[model samples]
Target: MNQTYHVYILASARNGTLYTGVTGDLAQRMWQHRNGKGAKFASKYGVHRLVHAEAFTNVNDAIAREKAIKKWRRAWKLELIERGNPQWLDLYDRLNG
Candidate 1:
């Protein structure tokens, strides 16, 4: 199988809106969002800025993390992103094109 590691969150813009998800292909995922084809929630709400992500050894863990984040309060979710990425720069930039 293709290798991948992701539990991620995206915001519309600085604090505009938020989304939580899991995906193996971070770059492709972000590209889809950038093009407004990622998900209904992302396209409608404009949650396309990859503000946060976590790595896992496998999909199980990534899914668990995604579930955990889904249960978090919006403020807590914001805190998670603020802890590592105060500026919330598009993390996709860290990856090669």
Candidate 2:
């Protein structure tokens, strides 16, 4: 089966701390973040709300996007998230449900 990769952003709250990452399983990754078992930066800042995500069939593309976003200015990153999630909603429940 073909695997999907995702570049995702997590936030502590609306307009709060942010974390960017790439994952093969978004659902599982979000679970780890929520449980305090994901990236140390995220856990340390309580950045567990899924605010933005993009899926790619190619892992390389996903990784590239993730790296690019990680390097983006905070305002740019916020704009990216707000374009799709203006409310900065936690997308975790939406992904699972």
Candidate 3:
């Protein structure tokens, strides 16, 4: 089976605290974040809503994209999210559906 990699962004709310990360299993990672068992930054900042995500075939590319997004200005990050998720809705349920 081919492994899928993802570059994802989580937010506390619309235009709220944001966290960028990379993972092989997006559902599991989002579960951790929502349960406060994910990144310290995410838990501390209450950033659990899945606002943006991009799938990658390469883990290295996912990691690099995550790093780049993390380093981006807040405006750019928000723009990225808004491009796909205009309302900044939690995408967890959609992942399964």
How do the predictions measure up, each by TM-score? Answer: 0.91, 0.97, 0.96
User: Candidate 1 local accuracy as lDDT?
Assistant: 0.88
lDDT of 2 by residue, 1-90 (tens): 899999999999999999999999999999898898999999999999999999999999999899999899999999999999998888
Q: List the residue pairs that clash in candidate 3.
A: none
In candidate 1, what are the lDDT values of residues 1-97, reduced to their tens digit? Answer: 5577799999988777999989888888889988978888999987888899897878888998899899999999998999999998988888784
Regions of candidate 1 where Cα sits further than 4 Å from its true position: none
Each model's lDDT: 0.88, 0.93, 0.92
Candidates ranked by TM-score: 2, 3, 1
As for TM-score, the candidate ahead, 2 or 3, is 2
Question: Pairing residues by index, what is the TM-score of model 1?
Answer: 0.91
Sort order, lDDT high to low: 2, 3, 1
Q: In model 2, what is the error at residue 52, expressed in angstroms? A: 0.2
TM-score of 3: 0.96
Model 1, clash count? Answer: 0
